[model samples]
Target: MLALAALLPLAGASFAQQKIEQQMSYEQFKAAGLDRLSPEQLANLNDWLDGKLKVETAKAAETAKQSGGDEDRRGLFLATSREPVDGTITGNFTGFGKGRSFTLDNGQVWQQIDDVSLTGVKDANPKVKITPSVIGSAWYLSIEGFNARAKVQRVK
Candidate 1:
């Protein structure tokens, strides 16, 4: 029992580290093949990536909305390359100006804007400002451009 206890923390830490590494590796793998992700995988990845984008966009929008009349009109926009490569970047843009709002899934609202465009990147460290739009009805997200647009709605 003592030996087991001694190893438990190490085991847990290793497991946690492995999970993080796996997630990173999976992201890398996906980014490397932006043109060739399986439909299912692509769908899943887009959903995941969009979820993160929504949170950041919403925060920026809320801040801008609250910054009074003196606030800048530019909105924030962010985009990440669906490529799998090491040291790849996740692109981001701030101050995108105003955009249009729409309904998404699950009684959620989103604002859509066409502000910035980025490609061949992976992760974004700095938060960006862009347009926010609804994802079906339940969630709000950001859409960066026309060609790089990703339409994601709820599943049933």
Candidate 2:
């Protein structure tokens, strides 16, 4: 539900229920031949656009995640990108757990996606190094002086 909310271009917007009315300028609407459609025809057109938008949006999101990826790429990233990100964890790091998240000094936020936990430890601004897996899209976050590493996914 949150993802859908985030995906929508307009707040509280639902493509399925939306009509072409007021969605375009009067001149543009006539040019697009939407002015000639009957009420039922207009509804059918809206339904068609709704289905098309949902399918295309999902495809684009998937492509972006697989290439530029789950993290905010700032600009772009190649699938062969193997860059290691090293930065200090923002604020206090109270150890790791599944779904735990850490923001870095570089403005990237990553959350643990695995069941691995590193508990009973606390540190302010712990150093973090995240590197992509050699064989897959997975990224592992490693804290300085810690042997255990947690699988992480970029959220921002």
Candidate 3:
């Protein structure tokens, strides 16, 4: 049900794109006092409606994309963290440092954005969690065994 709700607006957006003139019969258009509108006025109205539809479509796409069950595709945008994500490092897990990039098994790559580091620790395919900060949009990446975590930003 929740998935359907997320997709409903996207479906409506494509179907609701009919031009204003095409949405009504001639008599209905004239009855609405729209017949008196100049050609430019009607054009302006249609353009405005199109612009609004575009905005709504973009919003709907974002909402649908954010609906869970798609963890593999997330953290590809910069400076935005909607929720926590868990995945393992693709290969060897070395300690983290500023400017270091970690590629998850799901193919999402996160780059360290802070000066924090966890060195002298080595593990292969260590499980990790990337969590969003409470006060802001910042995110932190934590390895399974290490106590240190680094502030991270999605780069891919």
The sequence of per-residue lDDT tens digits that candidate 3 reaches over residues 1-156 is: 132132123211333455667766788677667778899988887676666667765664566556642444444532222457899999888798889999998788999989997788779999999976432246789999788899998887
lDDT of 2 at 12: 15
Can you rank all candidates by lDDT, best first?
Answer: 3, 2, 1
TM-score of each: 0.26, 0.51, 0.52
Deviation of model 1 at 31, angstroms: 8.3
Whole-model lDDT, model 1 = 0.32
RMSD in Å for all candidates? 18.3, 15.7, 17.3
- The list of candidate 1 runs beyond 4 A from truth reads 1-31, 69-72, 75-156
* Residue 150 lDDT, candidate 3, scale 0-100: 91
Q: Please provide, for model 2 over 87-148, each residue's C-alpha lDDT reduced to its tens digit, 9 standing for 90 to 100.
A: 99999988889999899998888989999988999899999899764322567999998998
The C-alpha stretches of model 2 lying farther than 4 A from their native spots are 1-80
Off by over 4 Å in 3: 1-73, 76-81
Q: Give model 1's TM-score versus the native structure.
A: 0.26
Report how far residue 25 has shifted in candidate 3, in Å. Answer: 66
RMSD of 2: 15.7
C-alpha lDDT of candidate 2 relative to the true structure: 0.67
